[model samples]
Target: MRFVPLVLAALLLIAGQTAAARPPSAVFLNVVAHQDDDLLFLTPDLSQTLKASVTVYVTSGEGSHPESMTPEDYAEMRQAGERNAYATMAGVANRWDRVALRTGTGTTAELATLRARPSVKLVFLRLHDWSDLHGLWNGEVASGGTVLPTGSPARVEDTYTRDKLTKTLTWLMDHFRPTVIRTQNPAPLSGFYAPDPDNPDHTAVARFTNLAAESYEGKAQVRNYRGYDDAQLPTGLDPALRAERTKAFRAYADVDTNVATLFDDTASYLGWRQTMLNRWPSGVSWTDGADEAYAVLGDEVKRWRRNVFGEWGKPVGLGGSGFAPAVTVARQADGRLRLFSLNRNTFDVVTAVQDRFGDYSGWTSLGNPNGPGGDQTGLPAAGTDAQGRLWFFVRNGGGGVSARQQNADGTFGDWQDMHGWGVQDGLSVVSAGGRLQVFATQCSARLYVTATCSIARLVQGESGFEWDTSVVPGAAATAPTAVAGTDGKAHVYFRATGTAAVLMAVDGVVTDLGNPGGPGEVAATATGEVYARNAAHGISARGASGWRAVGGHTEASPAVVGRGVVSIGVDGRLTQLVH
Candidate 1:
């Protein structure tokens, strides 16, 4: 591995600061399975966060049985290659000093320090890298299956009970105190990795990292990046960034030295380019782009929901400072209510739940169901079904539909592709007549003056969910909202193209309700009352007393909770009128 004594001596002689202590600008720690994993899955952002960053490799990339190289040679070469790769990323010389790091269990592992930039470091745990065997080990750790023994396999000496690993990780956190932590995807889709598909080692590392972080409860924010699934998804980076990534991987795969290596020319490393998808922390912005607007009413009030108590619990040093159209609300069967909103800081789907006693939980993220939803303009639709399953849908960045449902245990199922294409507008979902119906608007070029926008429907039937699209003609300019009325029929509402009049669709018939006042946000209640927000942001209902304004100015569209309606104020407080 070409260890030079001169560099080690110089690095040791000139050190007043430990790698753990640095200026509090930003410190990022990335925990990955193998050597090249961070480059393959966490990149451009990983490279961007280079200042004061530490990467921890759980496995030394030495397989259980090496066919062409000795285990020592393989481990050393992989470590050197990783040094070279990070050096290339930092645009500096490839010289690092090796040191010993004692874990919580009192055993030592190798830690490398970049000579040019002391802020960047690499810690190797030297664990076995067998795919099938380590996968089994990882699965056991993930499911709390078994406590792994220490000092097995003979080559690398450290033993790792899941608790020991977690403690060591917690020790690292307490030492470094990073501001941000990134790890691989701990959870993947069911059946997506059934037949020996994804790497189990990657999932295991991510889970262990999460456990450690939870135990430590440090100030650092955690983000989970997708691993092997990148190969199947579209490339997320542009050409320039992709070219730089190619260079980094080339360095990681270089193996012309005397030492045997895990990376060689035969591997398809050149073609390994794809977008890095991550579950951005609840309130942190992944990008600097201005927040996109949505035609749906609920999409605008997310900021109020996220920062209702100010910045006490905002994600990753971020706070909801302004208004955005990204809130949706659904009522649970037992008088509880769920408020869904896009994080003002991240623009990702985040939600808060209220119990029957009116106590609200902290806002939790469901992540971006679609990988950045095409153009970072993801429009979310949320509702509760007949069985109280909270369903979430998003118009993806590729202009396609994706969905997921909350399980009975309160966990969410993996996002499922609903296969609706060319859907660029906002979406609305309703559970009616024991069926879940999704409504969206699609535009098509016509033989007339301009393109025509029409409403499309996908409803669940005896044979499963089927598309009965373009059932009613509508404007493509704005989004649509739908709700199942107490009459056991579906009611859809939207603004007609180029008009302020609110249109209603029921039983495949479209009727105009006339313009009540200004732009109106509409919703149907449990009492069969169709309500809309008026010009002054007040709630008005089409009730037995005729269409009349009932409340004062509301910050956004009000949500139906049980038999009444509730709204949030600009000062981040909820006002419920139980009529």
Candidate 2:
């Protein structure tokens, strides 16, 4: 099939061209461990794909029991359910054209394309549910092999190791050349608990998928969806979305007898259908000083300096490259600005210091806390506490927060792990009342599904930091952005679950700040002004009078510097809204 034409057409159509109209060329590659996993966890995102899409099932999904049927029959039944579900999602007839393709790793996998919608394809690796893939990943079993389903067109005689599985997935990605890839969360805080709590096939498949994504040559955007762990979070889906997902899942549940009863258990099934969370949500990094604001524009750092007349000057690039858009800036007591950004290639936290002359030094790398090979760190959050000391905090590889403070003599101290686990990224740090208050969202540790998350606060104490966690009265959809108010209290802002309404919490009181309908990090300024992206992708700010339009489009969250609001425009340039 000619995919280049399709991609070109999609690009043109997305660019609002009126020329030759064609199907979208964008391809989505969704890698899941089980047949129903995609239907349960990846939808409305999976259903929203406009063009060609492919789903790779890494396992046969034949749990410990075959349900009075042979393992092959059970696996085939699951595959058939998936076909029907995909047909339902595509609004087509439940018919497929099945074939066998030999991969570069010498493995023959079954590929099925919807007869009515050829752009939708499915690849079944036919590996056993938990024992083959999960066991191999855990080193409990060294050599595992695939099993051909009952009506499969292929005969798989090859054995698979962890490395071999990763390579095979990479080969598939190379073949499909997807523009976007979706997979399960590799580092889930909780494990699967249905048949066995220790069976983590979803995690294993995600790990392999990430490895494949890293090795793939294409520039595909990768998004990791929370699997079973999403159950513990709030139900963020609207009723219409829940119904749509239920309809698609019901199509699959109708074919598989094992989970067909889930429909009768409305509460349990609704828990899975109502929530679909992304593991690494994008965060906007911004900071400001007395007369200057700094933010990441494109892959470089940019600064907007205030003139003598209090007019903001044009943004100037600081000449650093390969940096992620997320950045944090801390103003020193001596009137210098310190900028921190993640190196896109190495995932290392790099920083540049501004001198009195307003020029920035070259970015110096602060080695990843997880050591040289770890790529699990999130963007760094920087703040200046009492005594003119700079502190940097980042979500570590082990799902906890780690901190490093600047020494008095201009050097940095060793990283100290704060050991706060089950936390999402988008950390907010501010110095309030002569102490540092680090705010983060702490996920629930419940084994079952629930809508529970707390705003975790780490406050500086005389003998180190003390934890004071409070449950968010309302459901929070995104990570919280906090600012120290003039009253010396921390004000937190977050997008509410289900409604997408921006909400604020102060002194344990939660208030609705109106729904902007866009999802991202909410920006709270020190002067009690709140900013969020509206449905049209324009920045909206709330002040003493009410919410007002800021009149600029930004892909990243808005930030405040001095009295001006700054946002990275869609064109990767700085747009400031002066108050």
Best by lDDT: 2
Error of 2 at 414 (Å): 3.4
TM-score of each: 0.54, 0.73
Tell me the whole-model lDDT of each prediction, alpha carbons only: 0.57, 0.72
For model 2, give the 10-residue run with minimal summed lDDT: 1-10
Q: Would you list the clashing residue pairs of candidate 2?
A: 6-25, 7-25
- Tell me the deviation in Å of residue 165 in model 1: 1.0
Question: Candidate 1 on 231-274: residue-level lDDT in tens?
Answer: 43333344555566667777776642422243332222332343
Instruction: Residues 292-387, candidate 2: write the lDDT tens digits.
Output: 666643335677777778676887878766555466777766767788877645768899887778788688988778887555677788888887
Q: Tell me how far the alpha carbon of residue 93 in candidate 1 is from the true structure, in angstroms, after superposition.
A: 1.0
- Residue 213 alpha-carbon offset, candidate 1, angstroms: 1.5
